[model samples]
Each structure stands twice: as C-alpha cells, then as structure tokens.
Target: MLKKTLLAAGTAAALSFAGAAQADIIDLFTTDQNALILTDVGGPIFSQVSGANILGGFRDIGLQVFSDTGSPAARAIVEVSGGVFTFSNDNGIGGQATIQWDGGTDALDPGVLNTTGLGGVDLLAASADRFILDVLTADLGFPFQLRATDMLGGDFTISLTSAGPGTFEIPFAAFVGVDFSQIGSLSAVINTAGDTLALDLSVASIVTNQVPEPAVLSLLGLGLLGFGITSLRKTKTA
Candidate 1:
C-alpha cells in the first residue's frame, strides 16, 4: 500500500513540473492600437482600409515624408489590409522606412522587452526561442532585405525573395540571445531600391519556454524525497 502511494505521488509531481515548463506564444498584431509604437512619420493610426482582415477587421496605417535631399517629398504610407501590410512611396520617393511594435509601458519598460507583463512570471533568459513573421512580396521578382533591431542594439538581417505571392513563415532565431529581463522594442526596416517596393507582413510573435520558480522546484524535491522514504518503509515491511 505504501509503495503504491509513493508511486502515484511521484508520478503526479513529475507531471506538475512538466506542466510548469510549457512554452508561451504571444500575438504581435491586434486591434489595440496601443500595442504598436511607430516613429519617423505622422500618426501610426488605425483605420478600416480597403483590404482583407488585417486584424479584427481593421489595419494600422501611417505616412511620412523624408526631406533628406534627392528623395521624393511625397507622403509614403505603410498600410495593412486583410492581414497584409505594405510599405510604399506615394510620391515615388525611394528611401528607407521603419516600423516598430511597442509592447506598451504597462507591459514593457521603456526600451525594455522583458517578461514583466507576460503573466506576471519570469521566463528562461537563455532559451532557444523564435520570433516569427508571416510575410511576402508584391513584386514576384523584387528582392529586399528586412532588418530587425532589438533594444540591446542587436540587429538581425533577413533577406526576402520575391518567389512569393503566398505568405511565407519566416522564423528568426536571433532573439535567443536577447535579455529577457529588459526586452526592448522590435522594429523592421526596408530600403527601397526603386520608386516602389511593396512587402506585405502579418502575424508577428515570439515563442519561448517558461521557467519554474525556486519555490516550485523545492516543492518538487520535497515530494520526491517523501515518496522515496515511503517506498523504503514499504520494502522493509514486505
């Protein structure tokens, strides 16, 4: 009887530990405009554009004019429609543009992307996590480079091919080295080679495994020790 009790307790404890270490997936795009922090242009406003499901039936759009000499002064807009986001120059201006998603001050610190607002728990700082983006190109032959920069000044470049009308899942593993305690902002930039280079992006996220607390680990160890002691007592009696 004691052996059976110990076996059941051990099994339950192991299962609990496994459950505590599960991975979490966070959605990067949403109807909440506060979730995004944009710079280098006018209002990064949200509206119902003539596109498909960008997110919850609407998309965020913004326009900016660069006067950095020899560049077109037309208002270039970054718009999302039907889950697809496109960046193009309205006045045939060809230059560089940037878009960023800020987790918000309530969820993340200024210039920090830590796990504070992530369910009030801490995550493993050095886990092999992935930052995923669903993206494609408007021109099937135009190739462009997208750069992702983190708060700690870490830049990872992803070269996109134009063999795409269908959205492809691009997973960036460079986020594994990020400081989870002070995770900052996530931004993407593209330098247009011509007057127009339309790249569509959707569904950005970060997936990572959770870390168990020290108190939880102590409880697990105690449970195992109790089980072992009970099993030894049963063996002596038998």
Candidate 2:
C-alpha cells in the first residue's frame, strides 16, 4: 500500500511540472566502497559488477579489464567493489577497462548494455542541459573514450583526459550524427599508459535540474521523496 502511494505521488509530481526543465544529477556509475562486493581477478576474459553495484533500471552495464595491445600480455588485478574501480597492472601491457552501457538483455552478449527509459525516464532529456563527465581519481596520463550510441546504432566518440578531483564538460556540438533525444547508451573506455600502473576511476554525470524548488516540493507533499532532493548535488568532492 505504501509503495503504491509513493509511486502515485511521484507520478503526480512529475506530471505537475512536465512543462518545466528542472536541474538534476544523473548518476551513471559510482564506485563508493561503502556497499560493494569484493571481486579480485587476474586477466579476466569477461567479468561484471552486478547486484547493488549496478543502479536500478540500468541492470545491463558491464566492466571488462583487458590489454589494448596484445603483445606485452597485460596481467591486471581488478577491484570493482569499492569507491574506485582499481586496475593494477604488473607489466607494460597497456591495461584498460571497457564500461559497456548500451542496454542489451541478450544472455550471450559479453558486452552488456543498459536498457533505455525502463524507469519511464529519458535519461538525457530529463537531466540537465549540459553533460559533465566526472572522474573522481585516476593515475597520471590515464586516457579514456566516452562513446554515446543512438537508437539507430550510430556512435559519437569523445576522447577524455584524466582530470582527477575535477570534472570535464562534454561539448554539446561535438556529438555529430547522433540524436540527442533518442540516446541508446553510453560507454567509457579507460586506459593506463604506464608499464606498472594503479588506476582508480569512478564515473558519473553532474547535471543541473530544478526539482528542489519550494513550489515542486510543496506540491509533492511527501518527505519520503527527500532522497531525491539530496541527489541534486554531487556526493563526492575533489
């Protein structure tokens, strides 16, 4: 009964302000160690951080550790259940990890992706006007590629430099040939340049939405939804 009421109330609140553009934060992936599963691996062909590690409704995400260049044969110790996705490389194998976010439910698919609008929310449309990729901590000279796939299988790639304790604003105009309104998924391909490297990475989006305004709060009339208010701000600091 309580769950039904909360859901109904939330729907009302959303409909009440459907015409307005609100500021909100869309958490893509968080590596907070407080609640995580400790998985230790060495050169894993395919591995994933499931259960609580994956956010609700975005169940198809995947994490893969690999060597970009196969010659050196990179061996990595990966820790995905913590404040950072730690990738420790022993040799100069150019260690890297691929974060697959394109929503796919195929059980055989190694690269799992996220399902679009499963929660009745258009991630890109409901969030802020700008998209800022926030990487909390990482080794120096770390490089990554952020790929955005659309409904038609078209992709837009953005090369990212590791700016630990800071944020990078992805330019809106850079996503050429991509439909912003109908985005399918987003993948982060992270890499380490050093021979022996210890890289810690956490990815998220810092968006601007206007849900905490007094007018909206007063209309919602539910304190249980206070958690949403707290999510408006970034929990991690640089």
Candidate 3:
C-alpha cells in the first residue's frame, strides 16, 4: 500500500514541475533587459573618460536607445566592451557616455565634445557595458518601445543584441531598422555611428541575481516530495 501510494505521489510531483515550465509565459533574459534602450544620459549615468584613467563627473544627462522596427520583448542580448579601440563609456569603461547632444556647440551627433555639463553621450573604444531582453510570443502585438530619459547628459555607445530576424549578421540586421533618434515634439536629429557593433544573440547572455519566488519554489519542493513518496511506495509493494 505504501509503495503504491509513493509511486503515485512521485509521478504527481514530477508532472507538477513539468507543468510549471509550461505555465510560464515562455520568457527568457533578465530585468536588466530594459537597459538595451539607453536613455536618460547625464552625469549620473557616467563620469568622464581619459586615455589613462576614467575621470569623475559632476552632471547628469538623459537619453534613450531603441530599434525603430520590430516587436519589443523578443529575446535578445546586448554586448558592450571598451578599451583602446573598442566601445568605451564612462571614462572608457562603463561609467559615462562620451558627448553632448542637445543643440549648438555642445550639440549632439558629430559635434559632441567633453564638457563640464551633462547633455548627450556615447561610449568610446575602451569601455564595455551590456543589457539583455527576452519577451515571449505573448509579449508581441504592438511595437516594443522602451524609453530612458537623459537624466544626466552625455553621449554613450551601446551594442544591442536582438532575437528578431535581421540582416546578414547573427540575430539578423539587414532590415533590422536600427533608427536611433532623439525624442521630442518635433523629432530630434540622430547621429549615425561610424563603427560596426557586434551583438550576436546566438552566443551572448547576461546573468542576474534575482531569486526565484519562494512560494513557487516551495510548491516545486512539495511536488517533488509527493513524487518521491509515490515512488518509494511503489518499490516496497513490488
């Protein structure tokens, strides 16, 4: 009797765990995925970059990065690395963006320069940063638009990795529609990049520290205990 009961219970627990995976929204990635859309450029986001050591900053800038096309929530990974000739931010690392982009002398795009204030920004060839995104099929429908305001004010360079199909590159990119622009009532100018970013979602991902929900975990544990009992009963009966 105990053996029979344990077998049944064990089977039940294994099935329960399997059901949990199916019940999930079929999502992947981390909460940091939103970082894929760079925004709110400012002193708070970065300090300053020097050829030798990264300098501190005294300002804040606001900004945002997004893809003009495709669905939001899709699985994707962003890779940002900086050094001497790579993507660098915040004093050539992951501290600050590299410029100012509002208007005038400190205007953004190609005219950006190092200043004492936060405005627009970009990463350099010596820094690295990353963000990952993953949304299931249910996350699709309307376009995926995430915004990050220029809280500080400086330029930043980010490498966006995506799961959507695109050009010849991995994760695709030909018709990826990477339209990076400033948001405003009258549509601001978008500075085109001079470098090629390498973000292959097929091989990159981020690790997060978020813990699984306790209730869910407890349920999972209970399911296993039930299954084990069921199995033991089955063995004893045999």
User: Which candidate gets the maximum TM-score versus the true structure?
Assistant: 2
Candidate 2, 74-176: lDDT as tens digits: 4444444433444444433345565554433433663545433222234446644335444454454465565655665445676544432454344333455
Model 2 weakest lDDT span, ten residues long:
1-10
Per-residue error for 17 in candidate 1, Å, reads: 29
What is the Cα-based lDDT of residue 153 in candidate 1? Answer: 42
> Candidate 1: lDDT over CA atoms?
0.33
Each prediction's Cα lDDT score? Answer: 0.33, 0.41, 0.20
Deviation of model 2 at 65, angstroms = 6.6
TM-score for each of the candidates? 0.39, 0.53, 0.17
User: How does candidate 2 fare on TM-score?
Assistant: 0.53
For model 1, residues 114-163, the per-residue Cα lDDT tens digits are: 22222222223545233323334333333334333334444344444333
Candidate 3 lDDT, 1-238, residue by residue in tens: 0011111101223322211111111012111111222322322222212121111221112222232222232222222222111111221111112222222222332223333222333321112111122211111011111112222221222222122221111110111222112111001111112111111111112111122256744665554453222000001110
Q: Kindly report which residue stretches of model 3 are placed more than 4 angstroms away from their true locations once superposed.
A: 1-52, 56-62, 74-238
